[model samples]
Target: MSADTSSRSSRQDAFDPFLQPELFEGVRSRRIIAFIIDAFVITLLTLGASILVFILGVFTLGLGFLLYAILPVSVALIYAAFTLGGPSASTIGMRAMGLEMRLWYGAKPYPLLAAVHLLLFWFSISLLTPFVLLVSLFSDRKRLLHDLILGTVVINSAYHRAYTREHSAAA
Candidate 1:
């Protein structure tokens, strides 16, 4: 009768868009806002990292200048890995937009998964550009290509996670 056992019994009870439409309400728009905010944050972080790399280049007499080539990507991966994999499962930008990402099977995302998600995003955008985002328009859950590949969904934080928390608390 434990919550964990009950939840496991319903592994098939995935958050159904038909059953709980609230979860998907405004999700696509919210996701757009979240993406914009996260991009801005990543840009700011990249700028800071660029400055550090410049300083390192000065200290190392230009040897560290090589790192400048990879600094933005490294900073992005680290930021996404730690923040998306953190307790809230959201980046600072996501938090600002009141959104969170969750695995399709009702588990939290881990750092490795988060980092892979980010990499896939970059790859998909590079290859598909405008089409990468269009997939969400056709998906019931508003999942993009990387999301479908990773079995993840982004949800509004102001809604039903509290119901999940209460369900989980009984364990």
Candidate 2:
């Protein structure tokens, strides 16, 4: 008898949770929680960077003012890029909050893509003033400006059924 192609494909899809369309539903709340966590982390980083810049400025007799302009943006971009590129696909705060980053239509994005994603996020939020966030409200995927650009999505890891499967497998 010929192989049952439909069942075979279904089985394959089941084996790969990342490819499941339904796995991404209800992503908005997860993204909100993740953003809160990320915001805290960013705040701490910004505070530390500011202190360091202040010290440097004092030591340099005022050249530190120049450093202030770029430090926050630089810190945010570097941290975001590396975190998105890493295995967790999220910053430490996001992990602590049980969230993860994935592509809007597919799997985890590559580091290079994720970095660009982070950059776009920062630029829009920093430059657009208010309109940048409107995309999240109107976009079908509930993506912010950067998410739209990079096709990335942030979801709640705690409630994710896929997490259970992976956790069980690891155990």
How much is 75 displaced in model 1, in angstroms?
0.7
On lDDT, the candidate that comes out on top is 1
Off by over 4 Å in 1: 1-9, 165-171
**Runs in model 2 with CA error above 4 Å?**
1-22, 104-107, 125-141, 156-171
Clashing pairs in 2: 104-151
Encode model 1's per-residue lDDT on 118-167: one tens digit a residue: 99999999999999889998999899999999999888777767767876
Model 2: residue 129 alpha-carbon error in angstroms:
7.2
TM-score of the candidate numbered 1?
0.89
lDDT against the true structure, per candidate, is 0.88, 0.70
Error of 1 at 31 (Å): 0.9
lDDT of 2 by residue, 79-161 (tens): 77788777778777677766678765436667787668877776887899578767767865566777766667776665554
The candidate scoring highest on TM-score is 1
In terms of TM-score, how similar is model 2 to the real structure? 0.65
